[model samples]
Target: MQNRPDLPHSAINPQLVWTGFMAMCVGMFMAILDVQVVATSLPTIQSALDIDPDQMSWIQTAYLIAEVVAIPLTGFLTRFLTMRWLFVTSLTLFVIASAGCATSSSFGGLVSWRVLQGFSGGTLIPSVFSAVFILFPKERQAVATTVAGVLAVLAPTVGPIVGGWLTETYSWHWLFLINVLPGIAAALVALRSLPREDINTSELRNLDGLSLVLMAVSLASLELALKEAPTSGWISVYIVTLLCLSTASGCAFVWRSLHRTRPLVDLDNFRDRNFLTGSILSFVLGIGLFGSVYLMPVFLAFVRGHNALEIGMTMLVTGTAQLVTAPIAVALEKRVDARLLSAAGFTVFAIGIAMSGFQDPRSDYDAMFWPQVVRGAAIMFCLLPPTRLALGRLSPDKVPDASGLFNLMRNLGGAIGIALIDTIIYTRSEPIGRTLLARLQAGDTDAATFIGVPLQAIADHKGALDQKTMAMLDPLLQTAATVQALNEAWIVMAVLTGCAILCLPFARPVAPAE
Candidate 1:
């Protein structure tokens, strides 16, 4: 068979290749860091902006909802816009949004700006993957992915530490402002270094708009339902209605794609066993990943009475360990089947989660380190191989679509995981708190005897009791309940991680390298 001569030669300049790779890395770092940085800084933002707890979550939810909806459209959008144009536009939007976020005087304004940032940043992962694939040949693609992987993994891990420091020392605004410089640099480098490629307008015109709308609606509805389900009652009628609508919309999307000549996303890709299996694994991993990330800091802050900086420092260790192990995972990939490696990775992650389950309020930094080390190494193993296995067999033309779907599922999994953990914490915490309160009431005669100047007065007209006395008592009761709730949440996460380990057998072995 005659090979196509029109395709760019694999013998491109190494320096240019590195430059493009670094640009993609910079873009990814900006996107991911923005998300993680905000996690640690959320408290500061809440305090500065005087955000209610219920509304405070919108800061994260708005970004995720926008990002999720935008991700699936990457396949279609890339066909119309050149990579350079897309990267530059996205970076510009992200930078501007960051400025808006930093300067916003109200919580609503910050959330609105975050939505814009999410929309722009959503295009970044697919763009970076496409750029790396184009710059390197088949053999060296692993190396390229590894480099990108390191940045991708490290960004989220270090985001909290950086964000915490900035919020503690400077202000929460610095978290967003810090991205402006990197965003500008990435846009400039992308404009100068990325090679021009031929684009087919005919292909661009083939995009199915209806399917795009359906996908967006379905994902957005489902996310809204999940986010609210925790606090609004487990299966409220409103949630059920949204779930049904989301499901119907999703089905319609699949049905539409199957019939259309050039659907926004080809439904047939799911037929690939490896893709299907890898996607499932990715979803489960996402559950573990985001669930743990979200729960840990909250546990540290609310239960252990740690400040933002202390919590960030604890997480920083795991992030650093993951950074150190990323290259080693890549090297091992050369010699091992990705499936086996992934399974091993899941095992390590499960162990880490299990260890974390044992933590109490008194647990120190040393107690946290080993589990994080395991988790760091585990994530590198899980992230790289499954990604390779899922996309490796795809034809070059379908790679972009596959990447889009892959990332979308991962994000969806994260959303679901967060919802699940949040639900578990809420549902279980209350009952556990009540039980603890009852026990404390029964066990502490002194607490029971004081009565705090008559039960009726305390319950109805408590102005008589000193505010300082009430405040002091409130902390003791709250601390005990918080401890109980955190312990339950940790156990739930550990169990989920264990279930993820069982998914390894389902992953097909990577074919022997040629």
Candidate 2:
């Protein structure tokens, strides 16, 4: 195993390590929160900015694309920049970008700022993990992971609530502006507590610029293809061209990485069965994570007629549950076979997703609670143990590359999942909408009128429906349509989870450490 010369031993003081860990947690929270917080505020953004449906996705896409491009560079970047300096600089960039987002006067400006925010935010998770491992002893890695995990899980859960409250009570801008305070505080703490170390000038020169360009192009092109595939028609030339470009660049990335001495991604790591399996499982788990994240708020807002705040409060259950269960998951990983635990986690996740498929227009908030709790537990089971088991087998030298690759898979999976589910929803809703419209337009005497308006009138007035009228009848229609769409999506996710279950049989069982 190769030692990382850049890591200074003096940084491992218990109190300083604890302080730095807490600071990293703060940064991680802001990064993850910013990712999802905009979800609940999307409606507001759309309304205020008059963003087109096609372009609205770019709000999220901009962030995702930037993160995907930045993830693979973490290993190289750590070799040049000391972790303390990197942490402070990244946090500062994030804070400035957030402020820019809050103050942006146009949609284009907002998207631009979000891209900058994503660029800085992308370095956070890997950096946090690296800092924790470097600053704490091996035995305390679990505690560090727990702290980070809790923040990571809690961010998505609370994102909606926080974004909702800000969007509802104040304005959408506050969603971004709120980060400034925490960002500054985190940066200060990180700068003060995190130990500075020397850079590896030799490794610094090995940064693969061409590989980075190829990766960025590939991911960006793929994202565009996915976003446009549903609306642009699957056979559209733009989609085809983008897909081809993405495929070619992706192939080049792999070929170059494998054949080159100083490859950008170090493709050889995939030859490690543990790393390969872990990356695959991470990808699947990412589909579940991002898919549910995207689906839930859309469900609550469109189907249940809940305001953003209400939706946020509803999601709080999942976050709270994850916090409670994470420590237990770590304990279980220490005691039981991780392979079995991961399989059980996937099974539970599938069951929870399947339960989600059962929700109807009449389902109440209470009925939604247990499924979320189940998912929370499932996420802990799936994410924690598998992560431990996967990285546990790697030599320390390979850990950084393995971590980068693992995170990249998860991020890529998230992008693919969002694209798949969004496409499914768009495609499924059209025929259903058309059919429902036809029934409403039939003008049968027995047909139930919505808000005393004939079905035909309601369909025609979709674009012009007043808030008052929409408030009255939207829930029923949205509930029916959304439930069907979500059910189909969840079933697809369940199948993906099942694939993870099949892979679990191959997970190497580790004997307890003597």
Candidate 3:
């Protein structure tokens, strides 16, 4: 056979390459899907488990913290366990954890299972991207990456829709139960097909125990503070203590990573301008991506009085738009300037999210449609190209480390983003409550009318009805306040996204590697 160095390389067997690729995508889909799918049924789960509404946020927070903490260590885990064994172990652990979550009768038990699920599920995400760089030839990287990108965006997009239907029709347990079959099948396919690598136990010799400890503590405390900040008071003793400790630990973790020889994974990737720029975009992408997802469901279920099924069906619009844009994004990736694409993506996404800010109290399926479409179309351009900038053309040896760090930034951004928005919703509503109550106290008839307090009788029955008006008006006012807060949060996201344009110049185009 003639050797042609310039010709596209088919380095691995086609059957194994695609089978293993699809398997990873399935695992990625299942894991990402699990997070979003259960989001809608959270209220139902809280009710069923008899969990306190105050601590219910922990259900999502625990998983996010565990998942994010595991992300940067992916390079380490991949070194110790090949993609094949890692996926197998992670899939197995994920399946077991899902089953445990479904059957758990207590809050603690469910949360414990979720933590394990997060750690295992975390590995699957970066591994899918790592696989794209390592498994596919440069020529086909775009197509393969697009497939993974589609699943990543698609799963979350459909998650609530599927979750709402399942929870409304069957039970909340079905959210976790749905993962078992697919998880098992993905594991089986990956086990049979993925090419194996020898475990590199030598990579852990220095371990950097302090970095690992500090990393875990830092991430955990940060997530806790975010989750509790809204009600507990952002500057309260508990929130402040957690934030202070997290800051100390995070500073120490960075110091240890920079000074230590074999840091957990490379923090050095950020020194690269393109990598750093791409990372910042990824972080903002997380805020918009996870923030929008989190906000919409709450807005729909809580404010719009929509059921689980309706929220899910509406969310499907984002996913559907993503499908439409995937090919265009991939095509443009080759011909267009990457930094421009990123700028355009963030700009387009910001506009999309801003569209959501105009939502009314009566916002419904039709009202949310255009915003989801704009966001969905913009998702591909936001995700795929930055991925290339962050992970593309790296030394094969650096691929794992780069991918791990890259994905970690996005997830961490999401965890923090969720907390900020939660704080926004909690804090913003309280003032509105106080302000509205004051209006009533000042004998403002509009306040009474707003709450349907029969303003006609207010003057005559001022003494009797003042107390009654407060009681009647509280829930109605609270709901309005929440809608106002969500609108503010959407505007904030749009502004944050616009700021990503500042990071645009650093994400310069990387020419295709010959």
Q: TM-scores of all models?
A: 0.88, 0.88, 0.90
TM-score winner: 3
Worst 10 residues of 2 by lDDT: 443-452
lDDT of 2 at 276: 74
Model 1 clashing residue pairs (backbone): none
The model with the greatest lDDT is 3
Clash counts for all predictions: 0, 1, 1
- Per-residue lDDT value at 146 in model 2: 70
Decoy 1 TM-score against native? 0.88
Model 1 over residues 418-474: C-alpha lDDT tens digits?
A: 888777777776675566445444444433232222344344532344566456545
Sort order, lDDT high to low: 3, 2, 1
lDDT against the true structure, per candidate, is 0.75, 0.76, 0.83
User: Residue 407 error for model 1, in Å?
Assistant: 1.1
Candidate 2 or 3, higher TM-score? 3
